[model samples]
Target: MGQGARSSWGRLLADLGSTLLEVVHGRIPADRPVGGVVIHDPVDEPVYPENSLVLAVGVHTPDALAPLLTGAGRNGGIAVIVRSPVDLTDDVRRAADDAGVAILGLARGATWTQLAALLRSMLAEDDIGHTQAESLDGIPAGDLFAVANAISALLDAPVTIEDRSSRVLAFSGRQDEADASRIETIIGRQVPDRYAQVLVERGVFRDLYQSDRPVVVDPIEMDEVVTQQRVAIAVRAGDEVLGSIWAAMDGPVTPERAATLREAETLVALHLLRVRAGADAERRLRAELVSRAVEGGPEARDALSRLGLAGRRVSVIAAAALPDEDGDASEQADQERMAARELLLDALTMHLSAVQPGAAVAFVADTAYGIIPVADAAAEDRSAALSEDFVRRISGRIPAVVAIGHAADDVAGIAASRAEARRVLRVLTTRAGTRRVARMADVETESLLLELRDLRASRGETASGFLARLVDYDRRTGSELVNTLAAWLDNFGDVPAAAAATFLHPNTFRYRLRRVAEVGEIDLTDGDTRFAAMLQLRIRRD
Candidate 1:
């Protein structure tokens, strides 16, 4: 790994220091490379890579935090963040200094989850296993924070680079010098809705996006978030608007600075393109690794290792959107289906990763498969519950089916688990959204019947014996005898229930049942007769 392998501690502060965090104790080891982010769990200690940033949630006092800091320092941790208004007492400061660990204060309103996500994003861009690409203009490719800071220096003002939706992608330091609203935006990583509304109504976005020149805007009169006027320009790649740059300036147009802003826009465009390309590359590589591990061969172990799932017990989940067979057969419809599949895959990836740590979700052809690591015996049951929850969460948006397989205790067993999941999925997909989440144990009967149907068809077989007779009679007479028998069997010989199900009178249903027995030569009394009839009906095509 080179010096650029990861963002150093100094860079973390320079990027996040203004709004999200503050240094409360110890020197900021600016050059220390933070390897990863880890949540502190007392019962199950986390494995901390070198220079880990430990998020010590709920440890607030001097007595409680002192020992944890020592432990973290011994494990090569670079810093520990505690919820703010950090105690910062003399004793706590002494402990942090003694442990050689810096203490950071998380903003009072910011969530630990959001902080972790931000840190992980930074770390992933400089992951240890992959070599860092050479810098493109003295700044690392796709390093938006560095670009934002450089642009700020060139313009001599606090700046922010934002997506078209007004979500802040990156910001330079000295945000406090801008406005209360600017500070709020920096804290939330988004322009407040009131400010966005102000901009929208003023035709600010339309004018800025339409012209290459910087558009100057009057000061907004919203709450604390809007006291300063802003100069904004759209960042574009050809005709596509990638995002925009915003600077809080004291006065009006300087031609040279606006020209610099235009040049900076081109650089930001390149960085955005690189960021998108990197994400796609990472996704493709992950899919390949997941495919290899699920196929289970000599290199399966290596794939599992790369996925961080080696030596772990796991269950495979297979999920897909129910096909809209009745939808219009147009190019637009096809694109909609493809988009739906991608949405399902993204939801599965996010929800599963939340449910189980280190889970891997990826697409293999038309199906999206998830490998969820488990520590308990009821792996499939737990997976089913999570899958059901996910399906319910996205129910109205997309109708989907999810199948969970038995626990695979090792990498060698994962392939079998995936096969079982896919087998169950095949049965569920045929059922037309009847059951959205099912495990092999829950749908084994349906799966077995499907296998039987496949085998019988391949051998050129059809309905046999009494079932054949019932089917033939129904076909010739255009009667409901076959359906009558099915309803009777399904209702466990409850005549009135079967009658209601078929929307017929009880006497009519009873007469049909009698006809079914007599015309098909089937005795409705024998257990073997009922079982054989049901099995044949389940497997037969006609």
Candidate 2:
């Protein structure tokens, strides 16, 4: 992350500690810039970007926390967050110190998903390679957190900027000064239903939105959800209500503070527009450049340069979900498939962007492709490793295959790399196995055989010679002669193994093998004959 965008470690703790978070162990790196936030996916080996904050969701007990701290430290992580009520054993503390990662506990009510979103919103105001951020009245542009804090400072109260739906968008520090309801709202990133119901019943939202001036609400009469008085004003731009800003205060709102709240509302609206417009425009432009570059035509060179991959050797990673064998042709099913494709594409982009910063990922047609700038031809192995890790991470959730193409040295070779990557994807999708990631080199023979099968099918070919005889015999008598022969060949002529595979006694399998030879009128002893039989069996669709 750019300096214009990232938050320092000590600052994160100071800002969030009041409500949603608290450090459990290790020393804080006050100056370290947190580049990104990644959820600690326990099932898949993690990929940690430099200066990352890893959210260890569902990680309870000190034993689980200890190893995560160690791994995060080794991978350049800045900190880890587990759910609160942490045991924080001695071993966990030692591991955190050794790995140089701070373990923070999320407050009891906070959701990991919401925390991850809050952190991303903080860092993502700037682009991946953004150099410097423009400022709006001294605050960094589109930085809602800073805006919230500023409002908090001027009002001398903790603030929360919430959308019309009552979801918290950004919150200010000193939240500890607020009541339990405010704390609950911040942790969940949404107002509790009962609290929101009270507001609705009392017409608080109606009064707040209708009036331009700040509205003051009396303390709640219920349980200790709200004890502090609430001051809120709807955020707007020329009659458009963008959101609202709320401040928890002990005293009544004075004239000067009321004026300040109005001023803050206008600034907040402008910033909201800026954030939305900038993000949409940037995403469209970047997606276009990636799409064109990987497509590879007259515009490829310029597109690659724009993508920051100019003059660099690159490898392509192609990924696609295996077709669902049970798919129906309904429109809803098609829509579902398309949604799954986009989800996989987004996951690919996130994974690649974190592990390899300069890499570009985009969905081109049905395939999600990644173009990673590499050191050289040898870099394909590294690329393959990254792809494998990603596949393993998304394995059960998505039945997809990831394939690495050989390194492309220049603009001319980019298409070749993409094509080869598609070929590898083809091999993986057609075959059955737990292996979901591979490179062209690892499956060259399988790929060639697949191509041969395609050619043979296109030519209207069918099994011939002795193999055809056994097929006809099986079809006529309903015998297992051809399968028996295949099992024997598959086991390298080991009668016992072949019998085990066929669920038959060795003598019974031997009898079938003799039948195969006699029925096919073949020479079982010849190596050439066996090779031909195996090839035909593998390559023939029939």
Question: Candidate 2: which stretches are off by over 4 Å?
Answer: 1-160, 164-217, 220-228, 231-243, 247-274, 277-281, 322-325, 328-336, 376-380, 518-521
Give the runs in model 1 whose Cα sits over 4 Å from its true position. Answer: 1-129, 221-226, 325-332, 378-380, 432-434, 491-518, 522-527
lDDT of 1 by residue, 84-121 (tens): 87777787778788888999888764556546655665
Question: lDDT of each prediction vs. the true structure?
Answer: 0.83, 0.82
Best by TM-score: 1
In model 2, the worst 10-residue window by lDDT is: 1-10
Clashes of 2: 0
Error of 2 at 59 (Å): 60
Each model's backbone clash number = 2, 0
User: How does model 1 score by TM-score?
Assistant: 0.71
